[model samples]
Target: MTREYKRNGNVNLFACFQPLAGWRHMELTLSRTKIDFAKQMKNLVDIYFRSADVILWIVDNLNIHNPAAMG
Candidate 1:
């Protein structure tokens, strides 16, 4: 048990699903910074979810996932 805990070579996965239509989307990135999250959101809305009149988004209580991040 001499092995120490290490945190290298990890990646973040972002995904969403629509059960009604059995549709889903996912992306992977090295990190989950504000800029990366903002880009992911823009892609989701402007491209993937463009057909919807409005996007009722929800997320965990992550500090980065705020209105300020979107700006």
Candidate 2:
């Protein structure tokens, strides 16, 4: 799962992933005063796609591109 937060006018991005066959889970969060494309990609790597042996992820990164406080 992926989520975004806006606190004190700063944009924050977070991603979480879990392995189906194992108890291993990963989570990443990045906070920026503005949009950060590199941080977003890094979150994907550090959180969801950290393992080289893993091949697929079931979650989506849809809301990453949206504004911080959108409906």
Candidate 3:
């Protein structure tokens, strides 16, 4: 049997993609908690679409991806 390596910490990359615009924004965090995800999303939106009337974002089915996190 092979030995298993366990890690206590992990890095997460939060990214937003705009296919039509050919652009993306990314943020790295040590944890993928709700607060961290929300902060990353807010930063990206504030930097890229602050002046826009509406912005649409798509994301995978992550545990932290929910309305509570966004709020």
Candidate 4:
């Protein structure tokens, strides 16, 4: 006998953390498109770290995490 499997939609997680500041932000998005990645970055820059002179990010090798995606 074989067992059947069920599947559901996917949710992408975009998490940002500032360990020194003890701050964090997490977004749950339906798709992991370039636009979504851009939005997340925009939120980080325009809202979260607006006053910082420079912001550094450590990201995985996701296709959407590249510089081209910010366009």
Best by lDDT: 4
> What TM-score does candidate 1 get on C-alpha atoms?
0.83
By lDDT, the better pick of 1 and 3 is 1
Worst 10 residues of 2 by lDDT: 25-34
Clashing pairs in 2: none
- Per-residue CA lDDT of model 1 for 1-71, tens digit only, reads 59898887888788877778898888999997888889988998889999989877777777779999999
Runs in model 4 with CA error above 4 Å? 1-4
Better of 1 and 2 by TM-score: 1
Error of 3 at 31 (Å): 0.6
List per-candidate RMSD values in Å: 1.5, 10.5, 2.0, 1.4
User: In model 3, which residue pairs have backbone atoms overlapping below 3 Å?
Assistant: none
How does each model score on TM-score? 0.83, 0.28, 0.77, 0.90
lDDT order of candidates, top first:
4, 1, 3, 2
Q: How many residue pairs clash per model?
A: 0, 0, 0, 0
Candidate order by TM-score, decreasing, is: 4, 1, 3, 2
Off-target runs (Cα >4 Å) in candidate 2 are 1-7, 21-54, 61-71
- Residue 15 miss distance in model 3 (angstroms): 1.4
lDDT of 1: 0.86
Query: CA shift at 53, candidate 2, in angstroms?
Result: 4.3
For candidate 1, the 10 contiguous residues with the lowest summed lDDT are 55-64
For all candidates in order, the CA lDDT equals: 0.86, 0.49, 0.84, 0.94
Error of 4 at 26 (Å): 0.5
